[model samples]
Target chain A: GIQVEQSPPDLILQEGANSTLRCNFSDSVNNLQWFHQNPWGQLINLFYIPSGTKQNGRLSATTVATERYSLLYISSSQTTDSGVYFCAVESRNSGNTPLVFGKGTRLSVIA
Target chain B: GAGVSQSPRYKVAKRGQDVALRCDPISGHVSLFWYQQALGQGPEFLTYFQNEAQLDKSGLPSDRFFAERPEGSVSTLKIQRTQQEDSAVYLCASSRRQGNTEAFFGQGTRLTVV
Candidate 1:
């Protein structure tokens, strides 16, 4: 099974600040996604970037498949952005295997 | 239509008792997955289903855990002889295809085995 590791286990940022979260995987993956678990426990899909970069409003993500790493960026952070950000991956060799998740980066944006 | 929906937003069961959780994936979705997340921990895979077939269940923690998706749409996860260690949030997610793809998750059922 592949292992996913997230960095900056905890982060606190003021409104309008910018921050970056990272995820590293132990093996090559065919699928990679970033999710935001809101305060109410809804896991919102943020990005599905197996490779390259993608942006959605104030959030963006980049996955370097060759390096086995991915990054999530938040610009002009808001109180609404406070929650847990998770990175999950599914390995190519593992057929129909569920996605492996990282411990996650807990972000708190204070207004 | 709705995204993945889970019933019994929360459940409290006595030790050694059995519990069942339900999940309704998005309409027309072909794949479903179940995961467990302990407090302050990341979600761990429990099982996966492609349509009505359970293709992988290697992540199930023990024999006490079982899941089913007989109609390829609605799914259920049952835990037998529950223990305190089984207390966690049970999350259900679904994707459109069988291979690698984006998954939509439900709000999850928070179960507490007392």
Candidate 2:
């Protein structure tokens, strides 16, 4: 099994501020996804970046597969962005294996 | 449906009781997954099915948890003799492909065992 580690266990940011969260994995991965679990317990998909970079509105993600790391960036954040951010991945050995998730980065964007 | 749907958004069960959570994945999706999320924690993998066949269940915490997707479209997660430790949100997700696509998730079933 691969080990996923997310940095900045907790973060508090003022609305309109920019922030970045990181995820490091112990092994190579074929699939990587970023998810946002809002205050209401609904998990929203943010990105499915296995490699390279992708931008969606104020949120963007970059995965450097060779480095076994992924980065998520949020700009001009809003209070609605407050929630737990998770990074999950599946390795090359994944056959029927489900995604392995990191502990998560708890973000609180205060209005 | 446009997205995955889960039934009985919330449930409160007495210890030793059994509970079943249901999930309806999007049409044409081939992969379905069940995950358990404890308070203040990320979702943990429980089991996975590729269509109607359960491919892996290595993440199931114990024998008390079982899941099935007989028709390959809807799935159910059943926990028998529930314990307090089993209290958590059960999440269901489905992807268009088996292991290489984005997974759409349901809101999840919140279970509280007393």
User: Model 2, residue A83: displacement in angstroms?
Assistant: 0.4
Q: Write the per-residue lDDT of candidate 1 for residues A79-100, one digit (tens) a residue.
A: 9999999999999876667788
Give candidate 1 regions above 4 Å deviation.
none
| Candidate 1 chain A lDDT trough over 10 residues, lowest sum | A91-100
Worst 10 residues of 1 chain B by lDDT: B95-104
Could you give the TM-score of chain B for each candidate, in order? 0.97, 0.98
True contacts kept of each: 0.84, 0.92
- Candidate 1 lDDT, tens digit per residue, B28-67? 9999999999999999999999999998898899999999
Give the TM-scores of the predictions, in the order they appear.
0.97, 0.98
All candidates: TM-score of chain A: 0.98, 0.97
Instruction: Compose the digit string of candidate 2's lDDT tens values, residues A39-106.
Output: 98999999999899999999999999999999999999999999999999988774556788999999
Interface CA RMSD, all predictions: 0.8, 0.8
Candidate 1 C-alpha error for residue B19, in Å: 1.0
